[model samples]
Target: MTGSIQRVALITGASRGLGRSSALKLAENGVDVVLTYKDNADAARTTTTEIKALGRQAVALRLDMADTGSFAAFAAQLKSTLAGTWQRDRFDYLVNNAGTGAQVPFAETTEAQFDQLAAVHLKGTFFLTQALLPLIADGGRIVNTSSGLARFSLPGYAAYAAMKGGIEVLTRYMARELAPRGIRVNTIAPGAIETDFGGGLVRDNAQVNAHIADATALGRVGLPDDVGGAVAALLSDDNQWITGQRIEVSGGMML
Candidate 1:
């Protein structure tokens, strides 16, 4: 953080949606990026290209958050990428934002569904951060994605919210433990947005969109840029003193 070199951020699920938005926002602030995608190579490459268009270095790497076993290899690849692309051995920001959604009632939610949620949202974030700890610079930041569902009641999101709730707690613990190293850890909980998440239920469903808009104080459902800008602000030097907190980017939903 003390050098003239531009800061680098590693953002997961940056192929599209909030992740893609976050990547571009950071790039706009002169931060280089190393982003990941699960299956969409073309979209990931497009995000990298867009970042380059912003005059910042960017790379897209394939990653499966649900597959924890692959993390070691991924970390190795990242280390290599960093040395080769940026001539550095460490990155400054780690954004744990890769995730999927589950929409089943508590009573009907299968064990598999719950496990998948835990694997991607909770376990993956935890272990992936652990794996990359050595490569993250001393005065770095970590932003883990949470959800408004964790704060307000929402049917069909019990499992997903539970994992995010765990992430909120984990953020505090990470902040405390990583304090000696000057590593700040926080969580961002975004409200319903018009994304492809959960089969675009909030984006494509007219009734659902209107319901969320009416419930929100802003009188509109959230958008990718809303959360993206918030993330860029959170990771900015202006908010360096803010850590171990859950900042909800929900447009005052369910309030």
Candidate 2:
């Protein structure tokens, strides 16, 4: 997929979980990485070490998805990091993977909770990408993270899924507007992945895990690597023509 020309990817919230997996997969695919962590500096360092051990350069930065006011500064820091680390002004891939999770029933949902979700998942992604537009190389790829809940109904995920639904729509508009630069934008929706997300309900809870497995066509919940591999594949040169789409890495979940 990738030729001799080295590529670089920037993934937010990559200290652990799906973001960490995606960073490692891209490194394995010969792409250098710049990852961000909100508060877990130790985890971010460990991920960077892993990527470096793979013979690829990696860097970790601090980022908070809920702080849109800080995006301009973050972009400036990123610009400096790129210039110092790679001696370049642009990076080849951007994975908008930073977000928080909430699991409150709609009936109990609070205004603060909804605002926080929107701030991080919807508004944050939209403005962060806008701020970083100049630093993204022409013909680059952007994969915005969505969730399977956006398509399927789930009780406590009304707020979370709503933000992801907004992301799916934003992806199409991004693809259309960025087409002139030959950039590709798309969404990757993971279904019931066994991560620490949602307080590890899917990963640590037996009943929840069993229920997901029963509903999934593949008979199991998805792992982080399943989505990491998908991210690397989608950003590869082979998928140059595929953009403005929603690809679920859920092992054929829910039919």
User: How many pairs in model 2 have backbone atoms within 3 A of each other, for residues 3 or more apart or on separate chains, i.e. clashes?
Assistant: 0
Q: Over the stretch 52-147, how does candidate 2's per-residue lDDT look in tens digits? A: 999999999999989999999999999999999989889999999988999989999999999999999999999999999999999899999999
75-97: candidate 1 lDDT, tens digit per residue: 99999999999999999999999
- Clashes by residue pair, model 2: none
Clashing pairs in 1: none
Best by TM-score: 1
Error of 2 at 179 (Å): 0.3
Q: Assess the local accuracy of residue 191 in candidate 1 as a C-alpha lDDT between 0 and 100.
A: 95
TM-score of each model, paired residue for residue = 0.99, 0.98
- CA lDDT, every model vs. true structure: 0.95, 0.95
Off by over 4 Å in 1: none
